[model samples]
Target: MKALIIGATGATGKDLVHQLLNDKDFEEVDIFVRKPIDVQNDKLKTHIVDFEKPEEWKNLVKGDVAFSCLGTTLKTAGSKEAQRKVDYDYQYEFAKAAKENNVDDYILVSAYGADPKSRIFYSKMKGELEEAVKQLHFTKITIFNPGMLERKDSDRTGEVLGSRIIKFANKIGLLESQKPLPTDILAKAMINSSKIKSNGYSNIKLGNIFCFAEKSND
Candidate 1:
């Protein structure tokens, strides 16, 4: 299978790329990024692209399944508009190109509590992106909504501290549902979702995501 990915530089995306490259099912793993990545593998194809110009790279979106996990924090983006450009516009454009090129399956990494009617800016943006992609109507669409992702060697002080706090709570049998999810687990779940034969829209949220990771493709 041919796999296409956006946000390959991100924690979740990096794990997804590693898994895809190693998976026997995938023969080609294409990653679209703004800058070149250091990894080298026979199955890997890296495309340095300007996300704002979809027309130039839209043709390369063709693949069996496309993974969209691109995102940016408000602090990193420096403004809501810039954040939306990365979190929404770039991702939406990639999804559009994938649909246009007849990619039948798409897997997206969304956030917990994403709702179109959400009052929170971040939640609302995520919700809006979810809705936008759903409208494109891929043959199979799986949206995984994970809460408090546990990234490896994370530099974000708030995220690292929050993860530690959540782990302590989990140790006390509290907030199990909100336990920090590891990026590798999420990547495994996304790969597992693609192997499922059934088609249509499936939203795996929070705790259910863990189950998906353990699911057998056979």
Candidate 2:
């Protein structure tokens, strides 16, 4: 199977790309990026294109599955508008192009507590993107809503502290199911979801993600 990925340089995207390249089920892995990635692999293909201009690279979105891990933090984006552009506009554009190219399986890494009607800006944006992508009518669409992610060498102090707090809470059986998950586990779950034969749209929340990932590993 040929798989296409966006945001391949991000933490989760990088893990997903590595898994896809190593898995025997996916014969080819194509990554679309703003600039060239330094990885060298026989099954990996990198496309450097401007996300703002889909016309220039939309045609290359053809593949069996499209994994979208594109996102940004408010601090990194500098403003809500900039964050929305990356989290919503860019991701939706890629999903639209993938649908147009007949990529039947679409997987998106969304966030927990995502609600279109939410007052929170980030959750609202993620929820809006989820609703927009569902309209594309892909044969298989899986939206993964992972809670706080524990990434390796993460620099965000707030996120790091939040993750530690969540972990501490989880030890006492508080919010056990919603415990912060590692990026590798989330990536494994996303890859496993692609192999399942399913129709219609499905949302995998934090607890479900952990459960499914554990079962997949077994």
Backbone clashes in model 2: 0
Encode model 1's per-residue lDDT on 1-218: one tens digit a residue. 99999999999999999999999999999999999998999999999999989999999999999999999899999999999999999999999999999998888888888878999999999999988988887777788788899999999999999999999999999998889989998998889888987743344454635221121122
TM-score of 1: 0.93
Which lDDT tens digits does candidate 2 get at residues 50-96?
A: 99899999999999999999999999999999999999999999999
- TM-score of each prediction: 0.93, 0.92
Model 2 scores a TM of: 0.92
Itemize residue pairs with steric clashes in candidate 2.
none
The positional error of residue 187 in candidate 2, measured at the CA in angstroms, is 0.6
Considering every candidate listed, which one attains the maximal TM-score? 1
Count clashes in each candidate, considering only residues at least 3 apart in sequence or on different chains. Answer: 0, 0
